[model samples]
Target: MTNPPSLLLVLSTCLHLLQWILDKLRITRLAQRILLHVLAAGPIPQHVAIVMDGNRRYARGKGKMVQEGHGDGYMALRRVLEICLRLNIQCVSVYAFAIDNFKRSPDEVDALMHLAENKLLELCSHGNLLQEYGVRLNVVGRLSLFPENVQVAVRKAEQLTKSNNRSILNVCMPYSSRDEMTTAVEGCIREALAEDDYFTESITEDTINSHLMSVQRGSPPVDILIRTSGVKRLSDFMLWQCCENTQLHFSKTYWPDFGLFDFVPIILEWQRSVWFRRHDVLFRS
Candidate 1:
């Protein structure tokens, strides 16, 4: 037999459970309709770029291997992509892997390469996802550096999504803003020489921009650059393209813990901020 005098304790426990259930139900409903009708009628951002950080830290904190963190981050990326699809964001760029990461320990590098290769394959092979979203896939990087299989998958994904127009998703693998800038400079030099024999010796910022990875590919300038894991720096991301007015949204949550639920709030906040800025500009103009 149980003690009958614990009436207050029973009531408190019951109330806590009821509150938790209500909160869960509320969040679920809210997620199903985060934007509702208002956002559907307003202007949405055309481009969003994200720097995914803190995978290793998350794994360490959870007493798991670092590679697991990458897997978690991959899941988070998928979630964000889905959110972008629903939100009608025209373009999204994710910093998948940096060239500097190649200098990591051999074992870790191998694991990461494997993960990236698998992810690329999945993106290419997931017919349902591709067909449903109509997302165009683009991978910006030194493709020669990737494994042969990864190269094949990247090409396949690009081909599969070539005609789609719902959104453009850019995955940056073994990529860096500085490297892109250098490449752009070289391209500008080559292009300018073709037009006139008396071409100048060097490239200006505007010329270089015309040759940039996104510019040549026809991507809008990044309206928002989100950095996860509480990091304050860009880590060589979009150094040339991200201008003075480009907004930054830094979240404390690890990439793996990030999902559509996390994306909605950031996007809403970004919309508000962009509106305010545009209003200010209009008034000043």
Candidate 2:
């Protein structure tokens, strides 16, 4: 009879298999890196806005509490912020809390406010990623709608990071696109009256755009808008800032589940569209 394989032979066979698996993994990773670099070669978007949605749904699906869902969503936001920094995106605006969200149950609203206050404090802390990445934080919504303490925390965060120049993070709290447009109109009228004691020049798109909350923070119009939870509608977020060419991406993944890998495909698609558009223009010319 053939002798049973020696212990040394079995051990060697296992080692060989392990080595092959490790090599395959390394090759796969290198291929992914190459693809990512190729997708990133085109014009990077200067500003990106995201509507972080479905925190409650995600929590319920996982048999967790709403607060836990919100907490997870916060962690996702932190990760996405880091990813934006890595991508060299100059500005990011998130639909954190809309004005209409006040219609939620009182306890839920209170929990959200508490979460926001704690996060603002954390963002303003010394040597946090906001500081490390030189990110300026701005609360781009009506401050009076929030609790006085929340307002104070937001102002403190904004003041602490105002000097940073590497990037801007705009948190939309108690914000509505209609309300924002109304506020911009009022601001334009007030400025015109202050300058000439009357409306001299006709109101133009630039007049309203210049007075917008995002514009005041020196952020350009949104280049791409990604909404989670499979939401395709704008939902009153950044109406004026999403220009005609703004690439809109909707991901079925809930906000709490979103990660860098979910975002990479969106960027790749946007880059492909940009390339096609440029080629079309060349053909027309």
Candidate 2 residues lying further than 4 Å off, grouped into runs, are 1-40, 196-201
Q: How high a TM-score does candidate 2 get? A: 0.85
Question: What is the alpha-carbon lDDT of model 2 when measured against the actual structure?
Answer: 0.85
**What TM-score does each of the candidates earn?**
0.84, 0.85
Residue 227, candidate 2: C-alpha displacement in angstroms? 1.0
Per-residue alpha-carbon lDDT of candidate 1 for residues 150-252, written as tens digits (9 for 90 to 100): 7887888788788888778899888999999888877877777787645475566777788888767668888888999988899998877677767788888
lDDT of each: 0.77, 0.85
Error of 1 at 127 (Å): 3.3
On a 0 to 100 scale, what is the lDDT of residue 201 in model 2?
64
